[model samples]
Target: MADYSEASPPPKNRQIVLLLSFFVGLTIALFLSVDLMVGVLIGWIPPGVERQLGALIVPAFEQQAAPSSAQDTLNQLLDRLKPHLSAEQQQRDYKVLYVPDETVNALAIPGDRIILYRGLIEQAESENELMMVLGHELGHFAHRDHLRQLGRGLLMQITISSLFGDISGIQSIALSAAQTIGNSRFSQNQEYKADEMGVTLLQKIYGQVAGATDFFARLSEKKDLPIDFLTTHPNPGKRVQRLEKLIQQNGWTVGDRSPVAESLKMP
Candidate 1:
């Protein structure tokens, strides 16, 4: 009883300690929130690191079967389109890779890489439709949307890895989840921007925006939208409407359709 005063702290000191603890907790919470937002909304990974990560990540997800003949055809198409790209676009070293899959999907990744599945090529009703798809993917690359997507994915993995000390067994799971989230999360505004750029590129290369919306219009006619990582594009009907509006505004006329390349036959 005689030593109680010496053992007990003053009320002011207790209040100060409480205030400090509150601030420290608040700071930690704020940091975590910022980290989440950066991973989800502000993909800002540096280019070199993004390429390195892409080199490691993309191949793992691609089908191993080779598409030598289809690839040659794709390259020929790419070469034909190259003359129309601006110096800025051409200088970026854009590449289109063919994946031997029948998923009817295309993916634009970091390092200016675009992967087109054989199914998508076969699904196109005309050469103009296929070019529209290529142009749309190129638009994504030009805007660095591919980098942004890859960055966001890596950020999520890094965060999870840091918390768990490693992501050995979980890397595939994390990647799969990231791909799902990233594919579906591209905003409507971003979709519009890519569409606008695609139409512009089509007009530049082919002299008209004909069949720019052909793919979307076909999808819109489906009984149900294809549910897959490849279907990240905006609502099919809405995308067609937007493209039609843009074409009308620019006084662009639809051009004659060209048959799909014979060599582009699906495997």
Candidate 2:
């Protein structure tokens, strides 16, 4: 038998080539996936603003006068919702803030702060609809999305820090290349978790849940609402599908249909 124990190792050149190819392929695939998903999430965004995340936070979407009456309605909804929602479950420490913009959007910040845009408030067809939508935002927060964003360090720094020190420009170039894929690199399991939790929140307040479903149905029918690759909410049609299914399966009755929880609205 051959003296296998004494056999020499693979040649250095071959090892180097193998290693280089493996790393190169891995890096390409990893970043490609990341860029793709972020791109899709922000798809409805303007092309220029969509390109760089830093650009999206800017001078401000037009500021508006939030009517006192609307604020009262919102408060009524949150009061009921607070007991039902898991404050600690979503890794969020949330306090609601009103945004000045008219476009229906809500965002959760790192410190448990959620900004409810005026646009989102006014557009909601009913109090239930707004609660359902708010539930999703809360789901994102409890899931610790803010923490994950921080973990990414700098979307710009990943290249320079991961590669050679001189590779600063490579960050932008790399991000641009990755944007084409538009597939969120995070495991699909997370999305499922959000969906399930959101449903639970909706179940507790199905009237609000029904409102959310109705709102999505309305949004799906609209020609003007920007449905883009980068937006995270998915399509209103898909949302309606999921929301309706939840209702049908549980035969859940509507909860307080009065309006946005009174305690949640700003004074």
Candidate 3:
């Protein structure tokens, strides 16, 4: 306890601490800069490159999907929404791979494919509501949200691997990216933008925004189910409120909903 007030770290220890602090600070700065570049980088990615990356992941879903009338019907519905997409989006080949599973979820993967689970289709009470869900997925594609979900770390890895022509490394990263995409949750702002796009598309298809929020409203009531859709998506109640506000702001009219196609009805 002698002269404790004058105690100081040795010169060597101080240098070590300074080096560690510098590295930590540099790492954080690099992370933030990479994140900031993600939006801009994604815009520069061509559809061809996106499809190549998607090819690595699409096979897994393709194996799960069973080609049937249900899959056909889902694709047909997706086609209907195509006309309303932007000219650039319309040029890309989009399809739906319908999986006959009880998981209530839909996904827009990199390869311009929408994965629609049977459970989600069963939950839809009307054609328009189902279309709204489809439109929402399409919104993801329009905004390049699927790639954005890959996170900054994986994105930077992919970019670097591709730049170095490391095909094997890219494939490995793609596999991990697939798993991440399956469980990823979009940002609340991303969800809202998708909802806005969905409602706009619904209006174009039906001349009214009927059933736009019906699916979400119903799901919002069932809070106990261990549903993947609920797990990965933003709160349904919040989404419904936002959609209603958007519809009101835009003077969108609500009308009767169309019946779900027989092909999509649960047996």
**RMSD in Å for all candidates:** 9.0, 11.5, 4.8
Best by TM-score: 3
Lowest lDDT 10-residue stretch of candidate 1: 41-50
lDDT of 2 by residue, 37-127 (tens): 5544433222222223322221121133343555555545555567776544423234555665555666554334455777676666556
Output the TM-score of candidate 1.
0.70
lDDT of 1 by residue, 75-148 (tens): 67666676777777786666677877767677777546677887788788888887787777777766656644
Please state the error at residue 217 of candidate 2 in Å. Answer: 0.8
Please write out the lDDT profile of model 3 over residues 65-147, one tens digit for every residue. Answer: 98999999888888999999999999989999999999888999988889999988888899999899889989999999999
Model 2: ten consecutive residues of lowest lDDT: 53-62
**CA lDDT of each prediction against the hidden true structure:** 0.69, 0.52, 0.88
- The true-versus-predicted C-alpha distance at residue 144 of model 3, in Å, is 0.7
Please give the ranking of all candidate structures by lDDT, highest first, separated by commas: 3, 1, 2
TM-score of 3: 0.86
